[model samples]
Target: MGSVGTRFPTPAVSITKHPATLPRSPIDDDIDKERVAAAVLPQLLDLTAADLTDNAIWRDSLALTGTFRTFFSRELVANTWRHLCKKSTIQELSITAGSAQILRFGPEACWLQASFSFRTQGTFPSVCSGTLGLVPHGYSWKIWLITTILEQPLGFPDVDKLEPGPADTDHPGCLDCIVIGAGLAGLDLAGRLKSMGLSYMVLEKSVEVGDVWSKNRYDSVKMHTSRDYNQLPGLPKTFTKEDYPYYLGSEDLARGFKSYVKTFGINVTTSTRVDAATYDAASKTWTISAEREGTALQMSARHLVLATGSMGTRPVTPSYMNHGKYQGHAMHSICWKNAKPWKGKRGVVIGSANSAHDIIADMVSEGFTSVTLVQRSKTWVLPASTFGALVDPVFNPDTPSEVSDRILLGNPLPIQRLIAMEGIRACADKIPEYFERLEAQGFKTERYGDLWGILCDREGGHFFDVGSGELIAEGKVKVKSNALPLAYTESGLSFEDGTELDADVIVFATGYKGDMKENAKRILGEEVGENLEEFWQCDQEGEIRGAWRDTGHPALWYTGHGYAHARYYSRFLAMRIKADVEGRPIPQWSGSC
Candidate 1:
C-alpha cells in the first residue's frame, strides 16, 4: 500500500473548511417557528418528484435527509429523489395532519422534529412517517435531515406472520456453505450464494433473522450509517429515500431483513447456535456442532463463514471494575432496552464512544437525576450531519452501488485515511464553535490520524456526534475524562483520581473485542482460534487482516462490520467460495503475484 496522501481517484471535490454560518436573526420565535413549519412542507414536496436542480429552498440550503448514515449532499439527494420518483408514483403526501416540535433551541443551530405520512408506488402501498431536522436560517429555516420510517405497512408483506418453524435439526446434512449470524453480512452472502445456485444454510442463534437489531430494543438504537449505504444486495429498494428515508430503528431494520428473507427465499436456520466447528483438509469440509432448544445437532459444510459481525457477540466490561462490591445495577449498553426504571435515578455510564454517548443522552432525556459519562481516553468526534456533506457525496447515487463500493474499498488504506482526515478537518473548520463548546466542557476532542484510521484501521475510537455533543457541552451530561474506575463503592464509582460519584446504575459502553477471537475459540476450538490470524485489524498493506480476504485457514472466511461492506464484498466472497467448490484454480488475491 502507498503512504498517506497518495493521489487517488475520488469523486470528492476540493476541500473547504469554515464554521457553519448562522443567519444574523433568530427563527425560534412563535411566528418564525410556525412560518418555517408552514414553508417546509412545500419545499419537501418539491424535492420528491419535481426537479431539484434549481429548487429555491435547497438551492441556498442543503437538505440533509437520512439518505445514508450521515448527511446526503444536495446533489446526491437530488439524484436519489429522482431515481425513487422514477420508480414509484406518489399516491399521497400528507403534512397538514402532522405536528411539529422543536428539538433544540441553541443559538448556533435549532433542531426541529416533524412527521409526514406518504404513500408511493411499490408492490406495496405503505404509509411512511418521517422526522425532519431543520435549522434556523435568517427569518426561516433550512431543512437538514429527514428520518423516515414505515408507519403502516399496508402493502408490505408480513413474513413473520407466515407459519415456518426453525431449521430441521433432526437430520444431519452436509452442504457447500454454512453462514453464521444472520445479520447484514450473513444475509448478503446468502443472497449472493443463492443467486449462484449454490447450496447453503444460514444459522442464526437468535429467533429472528436480524436478531442483532431485534434483540437490541434500545430506545434510540438505530443504525449509524444511512439506508443507502446499508442496503442488502439484490433487493428492490425497500428503503429508498422516497419511502423509508430515516436511519433505521431496530424494529424496522429487523422487518427489512425478514422481508428480504421472504423475498429471496433465503434458507436460514434460526434459534440454532453453533457450538464447535472442526475442519478436515483432506475433504476440504467442516463438521459443525450446533444447539437449538437444548438439542445438540451435528452438520457439515465445505466452507464456513463467520458472519457474526464485529459487535455481535459479547460486551467487554472492565474486569478491573468491582461489580460485585457495587450495590447498584450494572449492564452493557448493548443490553440496554428501556430507560424506564432509571428515570429519576442517578446513573454513571462508562466510555465516551457512540453507545456511551447515546445511552447518556437517552438517560438525560428520560429525566435521570444525573448521568455522568466516563471517558477513558480522547475520542474523535464528528457531527453526524456532516457525514453526507463531507464523506457520502463522494459516493454519488448516480453511480452503481457496487461500483462505488469497489472504488471506495479498493483504494489504498492510507489514501482512504487521508480523505477521512481531510473530511474531519473540513468539518471541524466548518463548525469550530461546536468543538469550542465541547472543549470548554473539559472534553478534549481530536481526530485520531483520520476517521478511517479509527473506523477501518483500528477497532474503534470515535463518536459520531448527533445531539449528544450538546448534552455534554451544555453540562446536561457530566463528563470525567482520563479517569479509570479503581473500584466500585457501595454508593457509586470511585475513580483513580480519588473522586467518587454517586450512582444508582452503572452502564458500561466500554465496547467489545470485535475481532471475534474468543468466538473463534468457542466455535472453531482453541487450536483454530490460536492459529487464525487476528481479524478486523488492518494489515501493513492497509487491507483488513483476515476478514473477507484470506485467513490462511482452509475453506474458512470471516466478515462483518458495515452494511455496504457486506453488500458489495459478498460478491467477492461468493465468487471465491464458488470457485473453490467448483474445483477451479484459486488465484492470488490483492497482493502482487
Candidate 2:
C-alpha cells in the first residue's frame, strides 16, 4: 500500500485456519471483527502498519493525533525559568507530557507532550507519542518521559490514576526558556540554565541520548578530534598512558552521559523528537510541538534554542540501477548493524572518509573472501597506534653495533622528522573541491584550501587537519580510489574504470551535505533557503557568528551550525550560546552583540 492504497478493514485482524475446513468456509460467516480485533491486538505488543495513509484518519487525524502526544511522557526539564519580583518558588522544576487532557492532571504536574512519525522501512510506517508523566512522593519530585507508539487497533495510551493538569498557559506557571536538540550543546546549556536557576526545556529527536553517536553506528565512528581537547568540561580525563592519545569509544561516552544525567538529575526524554516550533511574539513564547514515537504533543516556552546540531538525518544517496534490485544486502555505513551478517561473504565497501577506511579494514579482517573498497575520493587517515613496518640497523665491531644502532635510533630528531613528513603527506590527500569552488567564487588562489587555506583563515583552519591523508595512501593498507563506482549488480560491483569485483555486500560511505540551510529557513524563511544567489549572499554576510543569520532574528541561536571540522567547534559553540541566555550581556566577540 502507498500513501493511499490497500485498506485493511477496521481493526485489522488475521484468521487462523483449521485443516480440512473448506466446506465450513464455503458457508457465509457473519463475524464481529471489532470483538476479535480487540482480543487479538492487545495480546500483541507490536502494532505495525504498511502505510498509515491507508487509514481514513491519516489525512485529518494525523495532525490531531500528533497534538495528543502530551499524554505519553513527562520530563524534569532544567533551565532558566523564573518571575522577576521574588525568589522563584518553583526553582528547578520538571514538565510532563501529561495525559492528553491537562485538566485531568494535578496542579503540581506540568503537562507537555511530543509525537513523531518516520518510515522505518519502505513499506512500514511508525508513529509514537512521548509524555512527561507527573507524580508526587513526599517533599521530593520526579518527572517521567513516557512514549506509546500507535497500534493497529488503537489501544488508548495508559493514563495514571491521579488526574493530570490541563493545557492552561494563562496562569502564573509559564516557561521562560525552550531548547531543542539534546546534544552536547543542549546539555551544557541546560546545565547552565539549571545553575542559573532558570526554567528551561531541552528537546531531542532520537530514541536514546547522544544525538550523533547514537544515530551513527559506522564502523570507523571514532572521535577524530583529540581526546585531550574533546572532553566536555566537568567530564575530565586526567590519567594518561604511555600512548600518545587515549581513544574515547561509544561505550565510554554513553557511560559519561548516563552519569551526567544522574549526577545533574537532568531530565531527558529518550525516544522522543521535536518536530515543530512556532514563535509567538505577542505572548513572548514559542508554541513548541513534537512527536514521541508517533503520538503528538505541544509546549510553550520563552527564549527558544535550536540545538539540533549539525549533520541532519542521513546523507543523500545517488540513484543507481538495481540499487534495490540487488539480491545481496546493501546499507549505508550509518546503518552498518554489525560485521557478523557480512561475514564469510565478499563485500564491496564504498566511501573515502574515516568510516569507509575503518569498515573496509573490519570486513577484510573478518571471514570475507575479499573486501574491495570502492572509494569516492582519496582521504587522510590517522592511526591511533604506530604505523607501518620498523627497521633495525647493525654496525661493525670496531664501530660497535650498539653505536650504529644508537645513531640510527638514538636522536628522536630523525624519527620525528620522518614522522613529520609522513604526516604532511597524509594532510595533502584532502579533496580540492573546496579550493576549486573558492577559486570559482573568487578567493585567494595559487594556494589550495587544504593546509594553505587554514593559513589564510585561522578560524577555519580546523577544517583542514594536516597529516591524516598520508597514512592511507602510504600503501600500508588496502584501498581503491581515483575511480568511482559505476553500478551495483547481483554478482558484485562495477567501477567506472571497467573494473568489476564480486561482492556480497555494498556499503555507501558517501558523505553528508552540510545543510544548515533548512534550519536557516526555519529561522528565517523560504526566501533565504530556496533562493540560491540570495542564500549565498545572505550566508556570506549574515552568518556573523559562524552560522548565525548575520542580520535579522537577533535573539535566537543555533549552536554547532557549520560544516564538519574539529569537534572544538562544539565547545566554542557552547560558549557562544552561553552568552545568549536571557539576561546575560551580548557576547563581546559576536558581531550581532
Candidate 3:
C-alpha cells in the first residue's frame, strides 16, 4: 500500500515484533553467534533510501540520547527510531569491514560487541569505526547499542578506545596517576585509582580539600542537590537540625569530602598548582611542572586526570562604562565572603541566576536597606519544596544512593527529557501561586524548554527557588527583569532603558568563562592542548560531548560535575585507567567500557 519508490511500512502493531515469525524449537537453544552477526551486520552495512523507512532494519533506539546519558529503555528506543527516521536520510552506506566478538554468554542471553568500518555518502565520507552492542532475541540477535569512534554521536568517543595511560616505558618512580584538583571529582577519582592498587597523587591548588565549599562562600549557601544524592562513595554527608533535610550546607558537604579524605587516606599534595604539562611521545610519559608555596616542583605520571570543574574558575563582573571611575564596592558571586560589611547599604545585584539570587538573599539577610535584582533575560524558577516533591520520590534519602543513580541514569537522554517535560506539563497549572508571585512583583518568568533542558543544555540561566523567589514575590527583594546596565555612576548604575538606580554596592552575579579548552591550554601549553575538544557542552545526541570519556587526546582524561556525576563516573574512569596501565584490552560489552 505504498508508492513505487517508497519503502513498505510494517504494521504499527508489529513495529516491536522480532524479525523471526516463529519461536525457536528449543527455549534453551544456544544462540548461533556467527548466524546472528551475519544476519544483523549486513543490515547495518546496507543503507538504501528505502531502508530508512523499513522498521526491521535499524534499532528502535540508541543507548545514548542526551548530552549526558548512559542507558535507554525499549519504549524510548521505538520513539527515538521514529524521530531519527524523520530527521535523517541515507544516500549511501557501505560496510568496509566488520567482525563480531562474543563478550559473554548465558542460558538466556548473550552479549555481543562488534567493530566495523563503513563509508557514507553525505558529510565527510571517511572511514568510520565503532563498537555495536547486540543481544539475542528470537532465532537471531538484534542490535541494541551503537557507539562510533570516528565521529562520536553528540557526547564522546568509545570508552574502550579512550587513551588514558601513556604507551612508552614506565620509568622508575613514575606515578600511575596524577589527578588535578582536590574537590569532589579529584578526590573521588583518586580514591578509586588507589583502591585499584594504582600509585596516584592528587594536586590541590587550594590549601585544603573542598576549598571551594569551605572558603570564600556566602552566608547560608548549600548544595542544590539533596544530601542523599550528594554523598561521596563511602562516606555520607552529615547534617544538623538547622539544615534542610534534603539539602546539605556548603560547609557540611565540604566536611564530608574532608572526612572521605581522612577515611581513605588519599594522598593529597596541598598548595600545588600544575603550571605546565608536556607529553613526551617517545617516552609516553608526562613531565609536569607545578608550584607549591612558591616552590617549583617536578613530577612524572603515566596518566593525567583533569578534574577541574565546569564552573567559572575566574569570576566575571560586568564591565560598566564607568566601572573604573565609580568607587562603590564591586565583586563577583564567587568572591562574596560576607555581606555583613555592606549592612544598611543600598545594593544592586546584576544577573538573576542561582548565584545571583543566593547573593541577593544574603545581602537582604545581612540587613541591606534595599536590593534590586537586574535580570537581563527570563529565567525558569521552581519552588524548592515543589522541586523536592517532584524529583525526591526517586532521589530521596531512604533508597540506597547507588540504586537511585542507576535507575535514573539507565534511560536514554531523550527519554529522560520527554519524561521531564511531561512532568512539568502536568504540574504547570497547579503551580500558579509560584508564578503569580513573581509576575505580581514585576518579574518576567518563563518555563525552560523540556523540564531539565536548562540544567542539561546550558551552564546557567535558571534558578531553583530555595527562598529567594519567595522574597522577590513578597516584594522583600526588588526585581528589574529584562534590564541592561549601561554604566556605573558614583552612586549606582544607569540602565540602557534610560532608568537609573542608586546603590552603594554592585554585585555582578554574571558568569564565568566556562571554556575547558582554555584551561587545558593554560596547563598543557598550545601544542598539546590545541588537540583537545571543548568540555561540558551538549553534543548532537543530547549528551555532553566531552569530559570523562576518551577525548582524542591520549593519556589525558577529564571528569567533573555534581555529586552524582562524580560518584557514578569515577568508577568507569578508574577502570579505563586500570586497563591502560595493564596493557589489556577493555573487555567487550562490559559496562566499564
| Predictions in order: lDDT | 0.64, 0.38, 0.61
lDDT by residue (195-249, candidate 2, tens digit) is 4334566667766666456445653355443334333323222112232334444
Backbone Cα, N, C clashes tallied per candidate: 8, 57, 9
What is the TM-score of each predicted model, taking all chains together?
0.68, 0.51, 0.71
What's model 2's lDDT at 134?
A: 19
Model 3 TM-score, 2 decimals? 0.71
What is the C-alpha lDDT profile of model 3 across 1-593, one tens digit per residue? 00111111111121112231111122223545445555565654432332222212221112221123332333433444344323332223333243555542112223554554443223222233444556555545555554433222212222222112232233257888899888888877876676566778889988888777878577667766566667665433323234535567677867776767776667788889889987776676878899999999999988888887766577777677987767788778777776788899988888877888778888888899999999888777766765676677876656655556543443334434544554555565567777887988878887433444554556667777777888898898898875688898878888888988988888888887775667778998775566666666544334555566655565787888667767666766776676667765232221211
What would the per-residue lDDT of candidate 1 be over residues 169-279, giving only the tens digit for each residue? 343367889998898889888887776656789999888777678775577677666677776776364456665645677877888899788876788989998988988
Backbone clash pairs for candidate 3 read 60-77, 61-77, 66-542, 66-543, 67-542, 67-543, 67-544, 68-543, 68-544
Quote the lDDT for 346 in model 1: 96
Using lDDT as the measure, name the better of candidate 1 and candidate 3.
1
* Ranking of models by TM-score: 3, 1, 2
Comparing 1 and 3 on TM-score, the stronger one:
3
The lDDT ranking, best first, is 1, 3, 2
lDDT of 3: 0.61
